[model samples]
Target: MEASSEQPQSVSVHLARLVIFSAVVLGLIVGTLEVTLEYKKLRTTLFEHSEQVAKAFEDIAARAAANRDRSLAEEVATGLLEFKSIASVEVSDETGTVLAWKECGQVEAFGSWLPFEIPSAQHTILLELSTPSSGGEAKGYLKVTASSAQATQIWASQLGMVLISVLFGTALLAGTLLFITHLYVSRPMLRLAEAFRRLDVSDPKNSPLPDPEMFRFREFREIAENGVRLMRDIKRNSEVRDLTANELYRSQKRLQDFAEISSDWFWESDRDGGITYISPSFTKTLNKKTGEVYGRTIAQTTAEPVNTPKWHKLGEIQRQRRQFRDFRYDMAIQPGEVKTVSINGRPFYDEDGTFIGYRGTGADVTNERLIAEARNEALQRAEQASRAKSEFLATMSHEFRTPLNAIIGFSSLLSMPELLKAGVDRVTEYSTAINDSGQHMLALVNDILDISAIEAGKRVLTLEEVEIDGLLSHSLSQIESQAGAKSISLIVEQNAQVGTMVSDERSVRQILLNLLSNAVKFTPSGGEIRVTVDEIGKDIVFRVADNGIGIPSDRLPTIAEPFSHSAIHPHVAKEGTGLGLSIVRSLAVLLDGGFTIESEVGTGTTVTVRLPKNGSGASGEVQTA
Candidate 1:
């Protein structure tokens, strides 16, 4: 089990409590001893001083009696007032009368025991040695008073001494604590932290701390030493374990990223049919694309503690597929097409051989599936085209054969006299028919060759600077001659500001010829076909507009699609191979230009082309036939 961070806090709490409790107890014990000793010493000194004062008063009284002067006792009491501990004294007469005193001079006292009730060495004595002289028998007594003022002085002195001692002791302890903390805790902790920082994650092996036990304090040294050893051992173990773990993580991530971009979704499911890991490629495959459908399994979000039967399937799947890594399967993909998946499932197990889950990836095989499905469709299209070409060739062969057979038979007949006489008109008609059919067949063969070559990417664009006015005029001239035969007007209205531009010269001429031819053929006798040019910012725009029977709106957009044409235009005119506009669009794109067509039913149609203004070098002009 991992240790708790609060474990150290509990130890520290106990240690701190012990330290604080010890300091308090020691302070109390030392303070009590100091105060007690001081009280005893001061009290003893005070009692001795009090005894000396009592003896001095007694001598003063005797001397005063000998001199036969009671007033002399007041003088002696005054003299004793000079002592520092003396509070005050009273000198009194023998009849309990007041005698002379320093504080209360010549006071009267009869018989009072207040004089001897004073503190001694640790006891209080009430009275002793206090009678006046009457010639061996006492008739009158002399009185004395002793002050307890010594007790006050001793208490003051003792309190002051204790204050000084405690202050000095506290200062010394604070300095010691500061030095110990810095030496043991602060500097050593800093060194240990710095050493730990030098360790790298790549090798978490036994890393020793620098100056691990450098703390001079014994406790700090021991802690530092033990902590370093423990950390080093853990680091060594962690390094060994993380090595394989990191490699596995990186490999899984790379595989997942690769699978995400490919055609098919990769999926892994347990034996009881719960998804474990679904690759992001789940949404798209070679044949079709889908959206996010993450409802794979209950464990998709969290790998749970297995308790139920469904969860137990992890073990079952691992037991079955332990030997095989992957297998293929097909799944239903809706809306676009059914997808084929090459799914590979492998069992992942814990150290104890209990299955954790299954992990695998899949690839969509839709393209492979469609190709397999559409084989006959492709075959039919190829076969039909082949048969059409064969039929065309055979028809032409028969057409040519009849002409040849006729011509041969006729020529042979001419060799005889009657056929020779019948030859001129009949032979001329047959010869013309043969020549026309042969020429038509030749044109078809050439068109077929051109289409084939174009489809096969044999054609290359020959770009050069084309003068807008000159190109339009040449194209219009050819169209005008053809339109004149049909009594239609073909006109060129080129604005001079339409500057030169780089383009495929032959392609441009072909585009213009195709547009103009279509216009003239569609226009009626009174209709006009106009070629115009306009400058449009960085590009030059060219338009061929016709006042002819116009195209319907619906068919206008399809004008540029290959193999598309409207039935409305030029019924008697020759039908195009439908590759013209597609070729035009392709050429326009090749020149980095664009084409657009607009028309309204019963109105004229306008076809426009735009090319950028950066003209090709004049020296690179393409010679177009």
Candidate 2:
């Protein structure tokens, strides 16, 4: 069904109608109120007049009642009825016997002529027939009733005058407003509308608006001037729009060509999210036919559940009909094969602004995903390395300072005049202390140099046949004093049949020293340390187990890393340089040996080093047990 197109009313007619309606309604309200107030005043005046008449007839009625003369009472009542407002008069004695009764027929006749009856007002007065010396006694009553019909008739006449005046004023006001509006607003607006109607927007440059000076009022003149400026702007915009349209067409063509050749595919879906149209690039990228995807929903084709957070967010965007960019998800191209897909899309709507579906471009971003992952991994490693370096420097500073401070303090003590003069025994003690500090500092520097050389692939290994028992004894002897200091028991389990192995003697000795030193450092008083050696397959395994404060499982992975001691045991005193385990791992690797650590918090730690009997120059991998 077609809608009817009604011709719109002009501004002048609409304004005139509005003015007439408003003025009439306001006038009616005011007129009605005035008439009501005037009626009330008239009613009050009539009532007052009735009361005055009754009072005047009271003395005459009293005298008549005292004398028991009906004629005199009748005369009083008849005189009271003479007033036009008085409808009826009645006289009664103290005994309730009526002396006179009279009523004017004119009031009844007037009320009958009216469509509605008016209620009358009545007044009564007591007649006193007593001397001045005595209190007054009512001898009779005089009553006068005033008909409200007269006041009502007067109100009606006044109401008619008010209504007539209101109509005249309302009409006059409406006509005046209409004339003024037509001359100033309506006529100018009509001219402007006519000018627009005749305007050819295609040739707006030539179809200029009428001059603003033609209007009489300033507001109309300004409006006309604004219209002229608006037309000028329209003309300018029209020319620009034409150029933009041409450029936009070319840009769209270029975009279409790019979309066809690009590896990324374009797709469109219906409101139900079912695939409707997909570009050829989709098949080329995903190795799938477009027909296979057509009936499938986005969730099905994308290989993700709608309940997943990414799809849930995408659903929310679609529900809101909002645009989305770089929406990434995984799609399965084949069994056991998945590709990360990134898409950019916007909700498409019909000309009437009803959402039809979504249209977007997508690409298989598998390679980009892998690259991003690699980049992130590298970044994390860099951060870890940076942190390790910072910790290493801090540990080195403390480690170096401790011995340096000891050497300085002891040397100062040895040089003291009073101490030297005391005895040679005191001087020898200070000298010995200084020598110990120097030895400790030397060991710290050697360890750092060893680690750096091994890392730089510059460490040369001296491979030789070394007795297992002698090597174990030497390593044990180096840490015996440290173990005795803590009262920790040291135990060794050696296989008598395992005689000797060809390996780097210095690297092996350093590894055993570091492992044993760490045990003594961490072990509590009365704790036990065990060293075990066994030949397995082509490799010889050395295990150092300690019943000491152990590493937390989470730190096990990076515990062998340089300077990780501070991170692992943050609450422990900063004693060692935190490079013992790292050095052990590196040396083991350089000798083609595998190093492993197994630990549990509050339990204990076990470190295993397995070296090939015949040393290999190639580096080995570290393993966590």
Among the numbered candidates, top lDDT falls to: 2
Q: Write the per-residue lDDT of candidate 1 for residues 494-548, one digit (tens) a residue.
A: 6666767766667678778778877886677878877788887777777888877
Q: On a 0 to 100 scale, what is the lDDT of residue 138 in model 2?
A: 70
TM-score of each: 0.38, 0.53
Off by over 4 Å in 1: 1-36, 55-69, 79-84, 91-94, 104-137, 148-151, 154-162, 169-246, 253-265, 270-276, 280-293, 296-332, 335-625
Q: Which regions of candidate 2 are displaced past 4 Å?
A: 1-256, 282-308, 331-339, 349-356, 366-375, 493-497, 617-625
User: Any idea what lDDT model 1 has?
Assistant: 0.59
Candidates' C-alpha lDDT: 0.59, 0.81
> How well does model 2 score by local distance difference test?
0.81
lDDT of 2 by residue, 1-625 (tens): 9777998777788888899999999999999898888888888888887777777666677788777789998898788877877777777777878888898885434334446755654544444443233358777666666777778777777777888899999999999998898877777888877766776888887785778888777887887788788888988999899889999999988877887799999999998888898888888888877898896777787666668787888888888889999988888788888888898888888999888988998888999999999999889778877888887787778878988999999888877788968898888888898998899899888878877888887887777787888999999999999899889999999877778988878888999999999888877889999999999988889999999888877778887887665543565444766789999999888887899999877678899999888665435332211
